[model samples]
Target: MSFSTQVKNELCRAAMHRPCCIRAEAYGALLHATIFSHREIRLNTENAEIARRLQLLLRRAFSVDCAPRQAGSKIQLVLEHAEQLGHIFDALGYDLKNHVTYHINRNVLEEDCCIAAFLRGVFLMAGTVAGPDKKSHLELKTARHSLAGEETSLLLDLHLSPKMTRRGSTYVLYFKDGASIEDFLTSIGAPRAAMELMEAKVEKTLRNTINRQVNCETANMVKAADASARQVAAIQRVLRTHGEAFFPERLRETVRLRLAYPTDSLAELAARFDPPISKPGLSHRLKKITELSAAEEE
Candidate 1:
């Protein structure tokens, strides 16, 4: 399934309680997530107005600000208003903090339908050709590590003038025939090994994103739990700060576990029990004793 579709399904599952609110929120959130995941904002031929359209769409969707710039011939897009964008994607179940945009490109050789199909949609613009024309003279060549250079060489070989285009602010190869030099790779028998390596790189990038997102979620949970524990600890610390007063045997054991292994989780502390205690049992016992001690003081 497409990432967007999977996200929609997940959102629907999560919103069984309030379908209407989820529908509205999920639409906006999905849009934000997809846009943020895009490595670059590209436009060609009829898509020349894409930058302007996206900026306006973002303004409407997010009610957040955006800025555009031109450095020489290249147009730059900056997301000046990230707060709402961040919030929206977060709500959509994407860990935006762990998501990062990275560049991925590969020269195509030998018309793989999968690749050809991917690029056809990728390069499609407002008025561009619906798909590749079989009669086009351009052919793709296999050249690894130098997408721009390989493209430049291929165009030079074909006696086509290099028409430069920007993938966002970065310059990439384009040709007068309304297709990128990358469009020619498959026609020239580019190496399969090179293409496989490119695929590997992209796979690694996706895996890293998955791992980072999981880690971020785990870290956030730990931080929240720790904050609650620290608040209770702070009160106890104040009570016991001045001098070591004798706590009841049970309370002493609880206090000892809390002190000796300050960073250990409640479960780990419980496991240290001569007869292992359940986390809830340890917690309840500690709470009751603390209350009793507070009552004695009062």
Candidate 2:
């Protein structure tokens, strides 16, 4: 299953011990649902689990029954009766007839647990998280601008910094930082999903570190091989122009070592000296040989 779906499914199993928390969660779900107004209360979802959870939440919170009906690939829970809709609005402390502006009932979410439950319900209805393998992102979308603003404030109250943007007619509240997303997931009762995200992040960092190390090593090997090949060619030219017998003892010894260990690194060749020399000393001798060969060619 997708990461978003996995998180939602886990959240579905979250326990609501208090009646207040249950009502808060249900209120969040209804507010963000496809249609939540006085005339009609409807929820449409492709996830059967969300549909089921909403049905149970409504019944538990307000004793309202909403049987989900399958519509093609989607499931919908609808309550059209005026009495049932009025009861839902009343239970949520929303006065549809008298209130000019719609706002979240902060009283129900006074406790931290209730706030978490409410956010969880919002996510189940209209939230999505990108797979950690791709990017770090978690977003909740709603058509109600006022609801989105209230959610941002609620998150801030919980010490979470969320960004808000408008997408067409919808307002989106999102968390971009990986740590923030993980914390949010954990707070909403998806600890397993949060752990998975962290694991994926660690695995990606490790893989990148290994690749950089391999590239550095490979580059060093190529540089060494190129230097060695040039050194060999220069030594061969010196020998051809001035026979080995004409060279001094030190130069002759260096020439012999180079001819014998064409593939050995400078350190390895240096170690083979009668009295081992440092890598820099060996390199200086090799440079002198190259200068002599160049002079002979000129």
Best by lDDT: 2
For candidate 2, the TM-score is 0.84
Show where candidate 1 strays beyond 4 Å: 1-172, 175-187, 191-194, 214-218, 221-225, 228-232, 238-251, 283-298
Q: Give me the displacement of residue 133 in model 2, in angstroms.
A: 1.4
Report how far off residue 239 is in candidate 1 (Å).
Answer: 4.5
Considering every candidate listed, which one attains the maximal TM-score? Answer: 2
lDDT by residue for model 2 (1-298), tens = 9989989999999886899889989988888877777888889999999999999999999989999999999999999998898888888877868632458889878899889889999999999999878789999998889999999999987889999999999899999999999999999899999999999999999999999999999899889888878878877876776788656677888888988898888899999998999999999998887777677768
Instruction: Give TM-scores for every candidate, taking all chains together and pairing residue i with residue i.
Output: 0.33, 0.84
Error of 1 at 234 (Å): 3.8
What's the true lDDT of residue 168 in model 2?
97
Q: Would you list the C-alpha lDDT of every candidate in the order shown?
A: 0.42, 0.88
Instruction: Please give, for residues 155-227, the per-residue lDDT of candidate 1 as tens digits.
Output: 4554545554555534444443423332333222222322433455567679999999999989976984684
Cα deviation of 108 in candidate 1 (Å)? 22
Per-residue lDDT value at 125 in model 1: 17
